[model samples]
Target: MRRSLAALAALLVAFSALTVGRADAADAVITDFGVQAGESDRVQTVALQRAIDETSAGGGGRLTVPEGEFRTGALDLKAGVELHLAEGAVLLGSDDIADFPIRQTRIEGKVQPWVPAVLNAKGLSGVRVTGPGTLDGDGKPYWTAFWKRRAENRKCTNLEVHRPRLMYFESCDDVEVIDLNLRNSGFWNLHVYKCAGVRIEGVSIRAPHGDPPRITGDDQPWDEVSIDRAPSSDGIDVDSCQSVVIRDCVISVGDDCIALKGTKGPRAMEDEASPPVENILIEGCDFQSGHGVMTCGSEATIVRNVVVRDCKVGPGVPVCRLKLRPDTPQRYENLLFDGLTLDGAQSLFDVKPWRQFYDPQGMAPPKSEVRNVVLRNITGSLRSLGDLRGNRGDSIENVTLSNIELITDRGDLRVGEVVGLRYVGVVINGDEIEAPDSE
Candidate 1:
């Protein structure tokens, strides 16, 4: 156990952020339970589930999946069981929606009946999913179906088409997800909801990158076709979760790379189930080709005390993005982004209203507030500078940018209705704007 903790510190971080499950010993192996390594029309998850159940039912330990290409439906991860995939192992999600049973899970900020993720965990503690392996969500079919639905109605929500994420942990504590290649997710790659003391480290998340072709025929082999923008395929969605440390992850996804989410509605601020997301630290991560490197909401109500530091943003990504919902009452404060090195990004800061698939439930729209936000020590070159705008009744106060040096392609910066905004040692496009000049 001492050796295991030492190794974990080396792999995840030099300083330990959180302590997870004890999975040093393997008590069961999936292949030992007559599980084959290929495709089948029937749900192949039965053997795997049996192994997990037997191992966890008795005193819990690690359950190993050996090196092979295994296909399965949805699976439930029990408490005290660590699903460790060996090197060269590949766990593929079945394309059949029927294989995934409908379960009550959170999607897009609401808890409703949806397809469970490839791996699900609920109301458990000391859970860990780690190993140098791959979890592939054969997601092209879902993407094709989503585009088709959008074409017909143009207003269909993401939940209209059932898509499964790679992994989902709900109401779990002391979780650690590390050292896995999670790709081609039908929806968000990793969704952590209401889970505390979570540490996500050294995982690689990739989504479809091909150019999206037009959806002309339903009978066409949509799976074989190319779709660059995977619908709702965010890399990491931390929903109403706290005490999370996301470090050393490499993310290149179609949607936002790291998005903070909470419930969204006129009365979202009063929603007890979806509490405020606070005390998060995101550090030493790499982002590429995502919508926003570090973003907050299309479905956030209250999020505070978040710090993103020492991250790198590749080209075509926005460093910071805030999606303020006009229909929901939001309070996002005490957020800080520091020591970010960006290269050729789209913009430094992008904050605007997000109204897609927004329904007010016929109630009066509520106002939002953003305060005590800071972005410091950010060195980057971006296409455009920023567009930070607030809603008419919204309040944005006490925002500061310090030690920022950047060369911009276009100096089109727009700021509106911000009180107590300040900049220190900021240079944009060879122009310096210090304390008194940038008030």
Candidate 2:
């Protein structure tokens, strides 16, 4: 919601001030190419791929997907072509992993030979996919298999199982995906890697959250069993990208609502494949529930210049979560969270060293830094303000909190290894905790 009309008017003014389009990218229809509606055959895949290829070869236009359930395998979206889903259309992913061909693509932090996404665009300049419709991942089978494998081996990575994402853009520029409902992704919902000038707007991304019921492999009833979580179903993963704008999105998923990532470890410093993720603007979005509203790094080296403003967040969403990995030399700086309204969450600022599976490969724990951050003009109620603790020899520097009025239900805010943590016009409950010398 933009809130009540009066509040919405104010929000619109704020939204317009906060700062962050589609072209006529559908000219042709998939059904026109003899694609039968509601068909899951290889014929559907061929027809769709042929349509995309022919459209691109014909100097680029939009290939429209009309109203129907069209199941297909991996699709390589090429230059100068757009996949436009009509109002009632559904581009469903196939259940068989064999349908998605394995390619040398970037997954998580590493670039390896993995399955291509349901819709993949690589090494192109102009890529687009718009929808008032849906891109369904149909991911229950993948979810069940991943959960089963994790049961056997406690040390299973996300890509160890063959799971395909809904959409992936890699090594491309000027990408746009707008107004699409992306749901139930086998891995991440929308992933952009090593790309620039990307715009993702008005998208609704969702997967199951919490211990919701799941259909087991035994063909159990949907409501009979409960799984822990949708394993690694992140909403949007912006890995090593720059100059991106994500606006007016509604996201709720099993993992992070939106994450900023890069390559991990000291080796990533000289690695040219994955660069730092920077110059991002996120505004006017709604994060219903996830691990965090915006998280930086479980795998990262440098993430900078991110601004998240004018968003509405529901419960169980950390406002800003920074996962500082001891094994990786991470530097997260120049982040700003402003003009937000939140219902309730566990932490408003949750920054802790992520030591899960800490393998530095004989390298010592590298020094990391989180600096030049600000959180202001936020009105919210949460369990705690946050737990901000940098590791030993690491630094959390120059964080400013201003006009942040919150009603916290939990214990006091924790702080350590922080330098120049400033507070201005801050009100918690009925008390005003202002520094004597404010900067």
Highest TM-score, which number?
A: 1
Worst 10 residues of 2 by lDDT: 1-10
Expressed as tens digits, the lDDT of each residue in 1-439 for candidate 2 is 1122234234335434432244554488887777787665443678889888888888778889988789988999977888899998989999889889888988879988999889998899878899999999888888877776765566887778999999999899888898899988888899999998888999999888667443335444543344546778889999999878899999989889999999887677777887899878898999998889899977878887787889998887898899988788888988888899989876778998888667889887888999888888998788888778777778888888888888888636677778878888888887888533311
> Best candidate, lDDT-wise?
1
What is the per-residue lDDT of model 1 for residues 1-439, given as tens digits with 9 covering 90 to 100?
Answer: 2342233335335335365557466567787777876543445798888878888887778788788778888999986788988898888898888889998899888898999999999999988898799999988888888887876666788889999999999999988998999989998999999999999999999997556567664576666766767878899999999889898999998889999999898989888889988778888999987999878898998887777889998888987788888899998887778899989988877887888778889998899998877888988788876777777888887778889998887765678777777888889878886533221
Candidate 2 clash pair list:
25-62
TM-score of 2: 0.90
